[model samples]
Target: MDYLLTEEQKMLKEMVAKFAKEEIAPVAREFEEKGIFPQEIVKKLGNLGLMGVAYPPEYNGAGMDNISYMIAIEEISRYCASTGVIVSAHSSLAVDPIYRFGTEEQKKKYLPALCSGERIGCFALTEPSSGSDAGSARTTAKLIGDKWVINGTKHFITNGEEAEVCVIFAHTDPSQKTKGISAFIVEKGTEGFRVGKHEKKLGINCTSTTELILEDCAIPKENILGDLNKGFKIAMVTLDGGRLGIASQALGIARAAIEDSIKFSKEREQFDQPICQFQAIQWMLANMNTEYEASWLLTYRGSLLKDKGLPYSKEAAMAKLKASETASFCADRAIQIHGGYGYTKEFDAERYLRDAKITEIYEGTNEIMRIVISAAMLK
Candidate 1:
């Protein structure tokens, strides 16, 4: 579907593809193996205007559209899922909320550094008790004089260890339940705010998944994001955009699995013939390609809807659900095609499977996605 892309988007796809193949592919395994963050690669990505590809130039962004952003993520993920998600979580979860719902002052204060990637950013909404039920979050924030003091622990936060800016959610009025939730921007070194336990993940180990502890963490009252007590709406809208990023990441992982399988099929032999010659192998390859294309088109549709300023929540949900599942499916099939070699670390098939599993779990689970889509239809 190259013909579907604008010239600018095509160029971005090419540029990102070239960069990922050259820079990320070689080092991805090494970084993941050592559980080391790809700091240098992330920094170079920032230099390339990829850190903020979909934002405006005034905020140090590349001023591209959502499709362009999707293309960049997909290309980057093709080589390294960890690197793809570093960009996605930063751009979609943290940056999109601030850019879309933030006050002019908040935008000016945060967007420049975040968009430039001089400072990494994270969104802290998930707690020990709250994942899909975001409204059930137990984090508390109290207004005292000119400041809001927050107290809670957020777990499973991506980019938490290295993030300089964090958009965190807390209950400003617990009596009001979901309506009580409010968003705030807290700096990394703010008093009583600290990073906590780093999780040992199954994959995407090169990226940090850690806990954020806020014990009476105080920030200016003005740090509240969007309107007071409307954090739920803000979160829903933000997650809608974030879903597209995850969808693109899933597409990348699926493509990687499919492409690697194709290459491996030609090289690996069975019964004195290349495995690619087998009918079963041919069917598996065909299924993988078909599923991948379907997911890609769904993601692209969601991106287009978002770019056009239309309601894309359902589309985003549909895209994320399908893409994430497709990633897992393709990776699993790729492993099957590789036979015994795929089960080993010597081949990337196992890693692809591990990495693809998380896509179905994060941003919003596939179960949640179906609910969103069905609700939209039933409504």
Candidate 2:
């Protein structure tokens, strides 16, 4: 797969991998245990021009390709899943929509700060009543005078607690359902908008998966993203890129599990010899590596399609589906190989398992991925 990457991309990968190993790995466990966001690391990433790898330099980004972005996420997630998502949710979920659909004014006003990590951003679509069925969201918005008044409670929003900017989805006409949904850019300190309950998750604990409450929150009419009554398309398109980001994260997790298991098998003694000598352990390691390579290739294919500006919704779904499941599979096998130590807090195998589960659930569940893939095929 290294042959698939351009020289610049390969260099980017090596640089990010080094940064993650040196900066993120030392603090990953402590940060997750305490639920502390890696603000400094994010700032460093921004300064290194990694926060917006795929965007152009005019927006203060690295002006790299999509593969570079995926490589960065994978390297970062290899050390810390929580930090991986913070970057993903900010770049793919939040910045991408603005860059793709925003007005020129919006781009100039937001992209620089966001790409520079001066301000964090989040995408708010999921709600208490709405998860996979985004069309059924109950949030509502109405135009008044010079403002659009929005009212909604969006939960499970990554980077919610720290996000200074949010992309919100709401219904302009509930009678029309999905067709009536619209996107809005709501800045922090907007009237009547506040961060809500913080969730205690099983993994990715350092991330702020919290609720965003909007009670008659009002923003300028120009704050509307894309077009009125066309937000569903925007959401769907944005998610295609986001799924790839998650897939890359999953690939990192799987790699972590595989690498750790390989290391442990050789050192751990079983009946007077290293456990790596056993066929069972060897088979597990072999399967783990094979699945990881498959997932990586899938994810890279999707990234390549995106860089070429092709329709990649189906490819993204497939990559996400396979990579997420592989992450869980590899993590479980890593735990089994580590025996009792893997189950305990002393080792990271259990943490890997916990982190891998969410990849299957978020950025559209595996069930949703199946629907997307099958729908594409049937069509």
Candidate 3:
């Protein structure tokens, strides 16, 4: 299938690419090195209508298509994977559920601030006990009177600290397994709600990754997202879209690695010739370019399929699995091409390698993606 960007979409891509180069690229290493969150930068991005790229303008979104959103993500991730994921987790995971399944009241209440970037958002699903088996979540949401009292511990939560709005998943009834799970909308500073156990990670450290402790945190029954006892479906759908965002991120990182490799090969001479002239370096560059192109095609296909209102689980899985693997491959190759310099923090090659790893693991692991793909094929 041939996918093409409209004139407006091309303009959107160029705009984000320029912003990434001028804004994100300059401070990306600084923030990653210092482990400081770019609060001001995120606000700037939000002002540019990037935080709500694919949502309707009525909800304070840019009203762009999913392909345009993917393009924006790819450009930002090319400069900083950490910042890229911050936007992805917020937009694809948090804002998405509310927009897709929320009541009109919920949308009016939350989307404005979330889309404005004045209030960040997070998705709370993974717990200390659960990762892949979301149905086995130990966190519980009980109906007490007219309110839902949530009691659970969610770990590895992206944007946990910064988010004012959280879309959380919990088990309302354990007996029914996954079918008993439910989703809720919880605001920050609710009584008994607390952030805990902040982690320092190998990559994406600039993004807030914290544990959420919700003990008897009560929200009105109206806060229930989608329908009761159908959170599994919501989570799956959210993940299908999130995978496309992550796949775009992987493509961005791969592109960055390849571009860096090419620049370094031309400047660093070996045997009195620029390494770009060497067949070995040339072949590595060629392979990196090819991998990036292939991954882009898959990711764009998933994005296009999503915008077209098609069932895209298999396509999203394919894009995420290949693009994530290709990211790691390209980062590793870039490091090899840079030799010892790539091993140090003076250059971004090592950071690229680190950032590429988590793409294989999160938004559902590559292993999970493989299962999704295989199941569809077999069916």
Candidate 4:
């Protein structure tokens, strides 16, 4: 229950909260309806040192901790889920890997641009054949003479269309199967790299989801990330951090729904009194608040354990699963509380519901989170 946040973390939360209110909230609806990625806002976030919240200043990062990063994501997501995902995917999936595993030369070459948002970054792991079974990926990379020649496709790649750099997984030794999988840093201008057609989705409409096409894409041998045949390990660890970010986003959705529901309940009258004054309405609000608080503790615990260099894979999964489901619950309850008004596009309640759904589906589905947790428990 004791958060005891450092001075820096408090400042970060306040700064991001203000920015979300003043900048993201005003345009969130228009952009979501238009299916437009908030590229300008993303750049502003980079300029504000949020694109790489926990990375070092030398790499153009804020040099903060995971808790600060989580708070930043939650606040931004409270306003715009699309933007929340953009920042999460860019920082947690893209930048963190390079910062964590890149060679000195590789870090020097990629980190500053990526961290500063001068060039956007994305991860390429999901494929047509392998979504949850990432180890079953069939993407191939042959080390030809000096360059690594890659041939395969990565589907459902967030930021794929706009990313300047990608942390891609491919099998260098197919005979080794999952063991052969290796991570690579592929630049956008590579000869055989291209973006597939964009996917129209149910929510998070403003973000891009496309296939990363690679046919004989050749890059320097030095581009190999981490050790050969260890990409699966790298990918798994990356997702652990990623789960925390998604959980925070889910928390944001729930928090936003609660704030809106309270505002509506006090103003919308029923039986000659406000809905909030009713016992049933009070129970709904109480349940939402209680679950939100519990989810926060789990989410913060995961981040705290991670920052302390302790084992937290199970904690991350638990937080992600609970928080994601909680988001959906709160969003649905918000609609129910609003009666007919919540169903329309004029209100953000429906948007929150739609946006909250994907939190369960991405960064490993809520189903996958359960699997991770059960496995951890059994082990």
- In order of appearance, the predictions have TM-scores of 0.99, 0.99, 0.98, 0.98
**Candidate 4: TM-score?**
0.98
CA lDDT of every candidate: 0.95, 0.95, 0.93, 0.93
Using alpha carbons, what is the TM-score of model 2?
A: 0.99
User: In angstroms, how far off is 125's CA in candidate 4?
Assistant: 0.6
The C-alpha stretches of model 4 lying farther than 4 A from their native spots are: 1-3
lDDT (10s digit) by residue, model 4, range 187-296? 99999999997899988888999999999999999999999999998998999999999999999999999999999999999899999999999999999999999999
Count of clashing pairs, candidate 3: 0
Locate the minimum summed-lDDT window of 10 residues in model 3.
1-10
lDDT of 1: 0.95
Writing each residue's lDDT as its tens digit, candidate 3 over 1-379 gives 1247888888988899999999999999999988888898899999999999999999999999999989989999999998899999999999999999999999999998888788999999999889998888989999999999999899999999999999999999978879999999999999989999998899977888999999999999899999999999999999999999999999889999999999999999989999999999999999999988889999998998899999999999999999999999999999999999999998999999999999999989998999999999999
lDDT of 1 by residue, 170-225 (tens): 99999987899999999999999999999999999899999999999999999999
Q: List pairs with backbone clashes in candidate 4.
A: none
| Candidate 3 lDDT | 0.93
